[model samples]
Target: MPAALLKYALSRKYPARHAFTRRRDLKKRYDVVIIGAGGHGVAIAYYLSKYHGIKDIAILDKGYVGGGNTARNTAVIRSNYLTEEGVRFYRESVEMFQGLSNELGFNIMFENRGQLTLAHSDAAIRSFRWRAEVNQHMGVRSELVDRKTIAELVPNLNLSEDSRFPILAGLWHADGGTARHDAVAWGYASGACERGAELHQCTEVTGIETKCGRIAAVNTNRGRIECGIAVQAVAGMSSIVADMAGIRLPIHSFPLQAMVTQPYKPLLGPLVSSPHVHVYIQQTSRGEFVIGGGSDPYALYNTRSTLEMKETLSAAILELFPFLGQARVLRQWAGITDMTPDYSPIMGESPVEHYYLDAGWGTWGFKATPISGKTMAELIATGRTPDIIKPFELERFYRFQQINEAGATAASH
Candidate 1:
């Protein structure tokens, strides 16, 4: 590892020395209070304190920091969407991720090992062209590759002619990759706390107190917290929070499930996915084969893993690599995702004047943590949403303008 990368990773270690111990009191008021201490909330707090000079902030979570979807995801990060806005926004995120460790003075353990989305059908190939063109137009490094290229990327890949969803081509995203999800949340939280932001775990937000159409304070399980501003970065509970403030966002809850196999020698390098198969697998640093796929057929808020999901996901995984059929699944888990109709985020102002929303992330929320923090910080501090995030406003539902990246999001997320 590079010296800078090593240094960055070391700083992200949890409960950094000199970190502030938790404080308990309802009398203290914060300038800003963000809900959900996952990667998004932590990053938001970090940017608010580090960039906007708003250090009197508090991040409250129902559990420990990053104990939510931040720890459950497969950690795939990419920007190879088939839409213009999606590509540009995520490309900016990818660029930020490159030096994020340095900027935050913590090691995020970002690995740009590239990502290949296999195409099994002519239609999948066509979609790849559109995605490649759109990504390239936005200055992103994405392109269509032939079977030979795919073979080189994953020599052990099974591309038999008669196999189900046989790989014919692929969309190669050169800049796409993965990161240590926990490290990201910890890095942001550690840095933010170092800058004087308060991180409170085991703090459950139960209600949003508003008066005269503006947020007055937050009612939590711990107690009442008076705040000047509140940003809800909670992924699954986004709708519940918005409803408390009488702000109806177009978001539906669904459970995204993933399973991992027992440890094995490093057999995979670049992240591989088959949109046609709807399954993705990557070997972690600990040698677990982290496996994940699309959302369930039904909309659900439950985070419990289902037998149907495991069977379906496993079938797809085996179809891609028959040799892995015997690999035992060590564990299966699920996380609730707040999926917007557009398959993108719904950020910016809500019905309540003092409440800002950074929700509707669906399964792709983890990848956008840093960018969302940067953008949301600017939005809250300047009282204006940046152009990049304006298109994702809640009002877009009325305009019927949706940025759906479902195709790209399904296989990899």
Candidate 2:
């Protein structure tokens, strides 16, 4: 199938019911006004109402709810990181995601299938060992597996001596998994709306009106929204939105591409990846094999897919699993990711008063929707940044207190 047709089919099979369909008169003064109705934005709205007792909230988006990165993500969730803070924070995120379906009273299809990241070189093995040790210390279910173990784990993978980027070992993360992307947004939207939060779609914010360095109102296509607090959870346009608030975030935009193969029997059991090859593959419950790699070497804001990425990623896929060479691809799509310097998101406060941030998600932000929303909610409602998210503040760049997860996030996220 073509990418659009396949996407339309998949979306129809799992349609989003909680889209922002109700048009309401803009409240003159909302306690909070969140921009970008993605997963992060909806999750924030839900947490604000449920946890913080703040009910008067408005979530504004330029497009439909959950139609941004929330719908475009590959949906991998895990916490087997190499850093203590990274492992700790993402471990919490994993736990939240594990029970997210039940918690949201909706079926998000959170799957805790194990993930295996292959190590093709001695250097890769060393990095895996370090990551496994750190993850274990942080109470994550990650371990180093040898070549024999790799053969048992994924019998069809090419581990022969003559293979390129030969599989020497793997970092097995038993806690890594995936979820239904749209369901997360719906759950949050439904729960938040039930708690009295208003959602407005087809609303474009053209300017951020401020006075005395404090947010006064937001000028939008619909009208000016008078608000007390504002958050930008718009994934691809994080920097653009932040710029509107006169904040210079250290975030860069890059396009990540992923594709699905025609349905086949469950040949791959766990999510498999390679840092050397910069590729990851896993079969979905519906039987399609999802394939993705890192971003193109160049930075781009485009969401258009390319034949070059498809050829390169397919080559890597065949290199790992040559048996699937005949299987045709069903679709290919691209999403713009907001990446920060550390490969970790910059959440919490900005320099501007009453302006908060939940930006810089990159390729890994979709899995972090619940956690980011919870943390940002706490910050906005309580007026204090949680310790878990304090290290990822926007001022970290200037303060030289960075949380670099590039090495660990590369293969796994």
Candidate 3:
């Protein structure tokens, strides 16, 4: 390689740890107080200061920014959802990601190679046909591909007829892809900082003081902050923060784990997943085989990986690509995901006045970061939930109007 190419590749070794400058002194009062400094919360600050012209903002997190779900996700981006509402909403998110690098003035390394969800049984193929129709009706690039096309797309896939679960067809989504997760969170944090937003790491919100059914102030480990509006964008700890405001949500926390293999020559391009086997696979830009699976069987607030789940995922991957069985495992990690009954995110208003919510994000939280931030900021500034996000309101549970995305979000998120 030339010297310039070598220099650029070497730059990838040392990553920028601190994404934004911080404020040592937390203000006694602010216009907005956002809990959780993950991608969603940070993006909300970015838009509030950049687009809505609200600068008196403070973002509080118990740990470092992007250290939670942002760092643990498989980073697969797609919009081929089951429902029309979901398809429309995620479609907008995918479109926003295409221009996010230019918008944030940072390169997120978005690779739109596409995604293929394999089908094994005849029922699975029928479901893909419906999903492809819904996706195409919403202007998403998806088609039902045959086994021959699957073999062409993934040359190393095991396509023998005698396998336990034979590959019949797949939903080929041309718009599905992945991006650098760290760069995205940092980009939003840096933009928010440049626009006069304050980021307070290691500052945990412990209590919320409500005055006459409205938010008056928030008590943190450091001190109390009086704010005009407060938001609980915390992913895993959604119930804890909402309880502080005298509201209870229908959410549970579970662990979602993923593992990676040693770097090898790049082979697979588009992401491939199997809902029947409960596994998803993608080759990263650095050549590691990035594999993701469904949430743990039991509910828990832990981030520890399990041996049984690893064995299950390994067996499924081997069925798809037997060549990877010999590759040594590099590392395994987990993140707590807040799951809801409908398998859809809980966004927009909560029961308490002046207290917004962005929870129940499950394994799909990373993909919705940009749109969630934009809509949540709009709701806080205008005091009205954006029309686009109305389908995901908290009252949807009581009204029995669930979006019912459980089919698509289960193993493929």
Candidate 4:
């Protein structure tokens, strides 16, 4: 072993450092104040400080970093959407994710295992075909695969024609993958802090004070701090936080639940999903199966996991892999998703001047972290909405121009 490694191994007490700066007194002012210290919030701060040279940033979260939806999500990444705009936007994100670990100087454990969305009927096949075409047009590696191809891709899948929901075809996106969810957030937060951004955990924003239709200051539980620009990137609490800025968002909150089973020998490779049955499954690097489905039926702000959802998910996964019936569930969790009418994110400028909106992420927030951060940072630094994110502007809703990704997002998220 090298001298440094030998010395460290021989030392009785190992020196360990915190990933990011510890809590300190909140600054009286900041150049930019970001609400929510999740992946999106920290990524924006990271880009702003590292790329834009804006060092005075503060990321405040009610809880610790990555403890909210960032921790709850099952880190599936893809770009096979039905809309042209969605495909283009997420394509950049997927590309960014491919090089993220190197850019951030952190090991995010990203795996390009690909993803297969099983089709149960003719309707699903049609939608997948359309999505595949759109994705292909955008240079994304997506295509519709027949039953034979599906079986070849995931041999263990229950392909019995006599099953309740027999697989007909599949949407195969070779670029689809997964990563360590918390590590992504930690990487961004650490990078931003190293670049002079402050991450204030447990600092809850209480209210927003506007001066002449422009964001002036934010009142938090710790204290009041003025900011030149304010961006709200709180995932589940997007609406409530925006309301504090006196800007009402067209958002409805819903709880999305997921569970993981005890580790076993790896039996799955590609991530699998069935939109018709509203469930997706992927085995992690730790040999545990992560299973998730659509958001809860009704709108709510709670993150409590439901017994009914547990039953539903168990049944759904069993239909696809009956051999996993004996695998014990380790734990289950839920995260609140801010759903939009069009099933797409609401990004860019809001009604309040100097206040940006990164709301309406729903269940697809984790996948777009890198691109959203870069674009939102560019908008804040240049005062011009990047062309890539123009389609997601808040004004689109007023003009009845929603991007409409319901067919793409469904259980595939």
Clashing pairs in 1: 8-106, 8-107, 9-107
Give the poorly placed runs of model 4, Cα more than 4 Å off.
Answer: 1-15
C-alpha lDDT values of all predictions: 0.87, 0.88, 0.90, 0.94
Off by over 4 Å in 1: 1-21
Could you give the C-alpha RMSD of every candidate to the true structure, in order shown?
Answer: 4.5, 5.3, 3.9, 2.3
RMSD of 2: 5.3
> For residue 88, what is the lDDT in candidate 1?
77
Worst 10 residues of 3 by lDDT: 14-23
At residue 25, candidate 4 shows an lDDT of 96
RMSD value for candidate 4: 2.3
lDDT by residue (316-341, candidate 1, tens digit) is: 98888787888999999998888888
Give the winner by lDDT: 1 or 3: 3
Query: What TM-score should be assigned to candidate 3?
Result: 0.95
Error of 4 at 207 (Å): 0.5
TM-score for each prediction? 0.94, 0.94, 0.95, 0.97
**Cα lDDT, model 1, residue 1:** 83
lDDT of 2 by residue, 1-413 (tens): 79987798678677756544378778777889999999999999999999999989999999998998898888888888777877888999889998898888989998888889988889888998999999998899999999899899889999987987778889999998988899999999989998899999888999998789998899899888889999889999998988888988888898989899999987888888887898899898889999999976777888899999999999988999998799999999988988888898898888889899898898889878888999999999989999999988988899898888898878457
